[model samples]
Target chain A: MTSLPATTERRLGLVIDLDTCVGCHACAVNCKEWNSGAQDSPLSDVDAYGADPSGAWLNRIHTFEVTPEGAPAQIVHFPKSCLHCDDAPCVTVCPTGASHKRSEDGIVLVTEDMCIGCGLCAWACPYGAREMDPVENVMKKCTLCVDRIYSETLAEEDRIPACVRTCPSSARHFGDFNDPTSNVSVLVAARGGIDLMPEMGTKPVNKYLPPRPKTNAATRTDPARPAAACQPDTPRPEGFLGWLDAALDRLG
Target chain B: MHPAISVIFFTVASGAGFGLIFLLGLGFPVGGGAGRAFAVSLAGGGLAVAGLIASTFHLGHPERAWRALSQWRSSWLSREGIAAIATLGLFGIYALVWMWSGSRLQILGLLVSLGAAATVFTTAMIYAQLRTVPQWKTRLTPAVYLSFALASGWLLASALGNHAAPGPWGIALVILAWAMKWAWWVRAGRTRLADSGSSPETATGLGFIGKVRLLERPHSGENYLTREMVHVIGRKHARKLRGLALALGAVLPVAILIITALTNAPAPVNLLAALSMLAGLLAERWLFFAEAEHAVSLYYGNR
Candidate 1:
């Protein structure tokens, strides 16, 4: 069962846009809040209040500064999690058949009961997607909010993942990549979305929208110049008469 | 790439045990008597079993170790488990036949030897198959493992062999292993794969725009990924360890074995050669894990 399926019916994945993300950690915070109470609940933290605090988190955001030769520097915020690849190494490397990719939805998941916590799956992952829960002593990773996405009780709009829902900039998009007309697919095509580390040959389901190129108009501006001081047009009048005229004009 | 002591002990001890079994299986039918052969078999088997057990010490749930044998079709670790068990079973049958029938089952001995060798190969493949660690994803990795196993096996066998003086075969094997390890070092040093294929730019998919560098880490403290994969050793320290490994694992053993062969030295000298080789191999194994750079470390700015 650890072997991957020949093909999945639907490839549900995320397309993250780098152009508008503010790196506010909202997605990561919402993900922790949701997954900590949802399926395989309670992502515990060890020494949370003490000197050394650590815990398992499903999504993480990293910021980078890119400076090209003879070009303006740009800041990029990268949110990373499991790509749920077509050929996930973590699934194949699991000795207990614990880690598996769903043939129906193309979502990679781990069966907690079957896992022996040997940490082989974590080693096999190239993206650093998986994290070991120090308190539970088992491997945990992004499940893509499987429970909420399929629930009938929640409203249609609320059925998306917590991270996607909580993103203030709408940087994360979730939909089926298999459907050409899907919003995610259309966005990907329009922006020329790219895979992270394609050389790794993971065929990751998730894609990243590159930062939009900065235009010359946006970066261009005119230099400031000093203005000549104003002078009174009628200065020959007597002081009382001038003062009265000025005061009458001001009042008028 | 933390080089946990449990795994280091497991690989080294198990490799040496399988190597001894490989040699003993071939040598037992030819010259060694039943009693001595049985004793040697017990020692080798015991070492291998102990190593397998030691491997579980680092696992979160040691009680679930039996479940690891279920996924042999895809996982090298699972295949290693099955092969180790099969090797033990085959050797058990061979030992029983020798004890009960007082006859060496030549065919069974051959099968057991093949099983032992296969087990060692599977163990090596566990690391070799990992594409995430480019240094380990090579044919040279397995070659080094097999050579070291054979070299240590021959050293141990030389000490226990029935002859009054140790054979030259052990020394020859040590030299061969040394040569192979040296070649591996030279090749690995020149290969780009030893570093990460994924850099900060590639990891973030922002390379097309410009040169990418980490501005801030994802978290303030170390996470599981950093703790498990991001190991950094100083260049000078690594160089010193490599020299130490070469001296203890190959040079010292080969020299002692050659001296013993020339002087017809006593059994103690052969024992000394085996001990020295083992000590050297331990250092070598430690470096193998410590020096390996995982692709995941790119995200952590370790590259």
Candidate 2:
């Protein structure tokens, strides 16, 4: 089962819009909250409330500064999770049958029971997509919210992955990449979505839309138009005061 | 690339142990005749078993380790585990046959020879097949491993053989293994960040944006990915360790072997040569893991 299926019926993944993301980390927080106690969950924390709290998180938001030649700098928020590559090296390198990709959907998952936690799957991934649960002694990864995405118990509108559903800027979109007309596929085509580390040749299912260029006109400050203030309509003040106010108005 | 101590010892001990098995299977004249198998069965077999036990210590679930052998079809780690088991099984039969019947079976010897070499090859492939680590992703990785296995095995063979002078073939194998190791060091020296074509620009998919810089990290504290993959050793310190490994693992053992060939061979001196080789190669194996830079570290700007 560690050997990937030749082809999946569908390639379900995400398309993240860097231009729209606000770097709030809401998606990452919600993902952790939802996964920690889901059906197959309990992503443990190393230090909960101590000086430096660290834990196993399936999603993380990285912020990068991009400076184009002779162009203003742009700050982009990159939220990374499992890309679920078509040629996922993580799945093949697993010595146990725990790491696998679904044949029906291209989502790669780890069956916690069978994982030996040898960390080979994590090592094979060029992207840091997998983590070991220090407390649970098992490999933890983004399951694309496998439990919530297919649950009949949840409402119809709430079936998407926790990260996609909780994105405040609507930067994250989840759909099947196999469908040419899917929302993600359409967005990727329109925005020139790209794979991170394409030279790795993992054929990642997730796509990232680059941040749009910001020109001078977009960033320059605009002067405000003057507006008349309400007048009391009272008789003019003393001659000197009136003359002073008129002089200031002339200067303005 | 974190050089876990358990894995370092496992590779060093088992590498030499299996090498000795390969030589034994070929009926190399180690103290000649009946009891040779029994002595080696204790020395080489004990070291191999110790190394295997040490390997399990690094696993998160040692009790579930048996399941690792079940996925040999695609995983090199699985293949290594299965090959190790088979090699040891074959060596066991070979040893017992000689002890019980005073007859060395040619078929069993040939099987052990193939099995031992296969086990070491699979072990080397476990590291070489990882494309995420560019330094270990070459055919030379296995070549280095095989040569070291043979050279270290020769050291033990020299110690165990009854001949007054160590064989020229043993000395030749040692020199050959060091030459390969020296070549490996030169190739790996610049491999940390250069020559891999993977840079921070390539890693973030922002090469067209002029340049990319890390403005903020995902977390302030250490995570599993960083802890496991981003082991940083100072360049100066690594250079010194390489020197230590080369001196102890190669130069000293060769000098001792040459001295034995020219003069009377003290059994103690030969034993010292084998022990010295083991100690030296341990440093070499440690450096092997310490110097490996994972491609995933590019994401964190650590590579």
Off by over 4 Å in 1: A217-219, A222-252, B28-35, B163-165, B192-197, B233-236
Which pairs of residues clash in candidate 2, taking residues 3 or more apart in a chain or in different chains?
none
Per-residue lDDT over A1-252 for candidate 1, one digit per residue giving the tens place of the 0 to 100 score: 899999999999999999989999999999999988876658878888999888899899988899877877878888988999998999999898989999999999998878888888988888999998887777898998999899999999999989999999999999999999999999999999999888888899999999998766445653453333443465556689888888888998
Off by over 4 Å in 2: A217-252, B32-36, B163-167, B234-236
**Could you say which candidate leads in TM-score?**
2
lDDT of 1 by residue, B170-223 (tens): 777888887888887776676534354667777788888889888888989999
Score candidate 2 by lDDT. 0.86
Query: What is candidate 1's CA lDDT for residue B150?
Result: 87
Residue range with the least summed lDDT across 10 consecutive positions in model 2 chain B: B161-170
Candidate 1 lands at a TM-score of 0.92
Tens digits of lDDT, candidate 2, A1-252: 889899999999999998899999999999999988784659899768999887898998888888888777788888989999999999988888899999999999999988888898999999899999888888999999988888999998899999999999999999999999999999999999999888888999999998786657655655563334543566766689999978987999
Question: Among the candidates, what TM-score does chain A have in each?
Answer: 0.87, 0.89
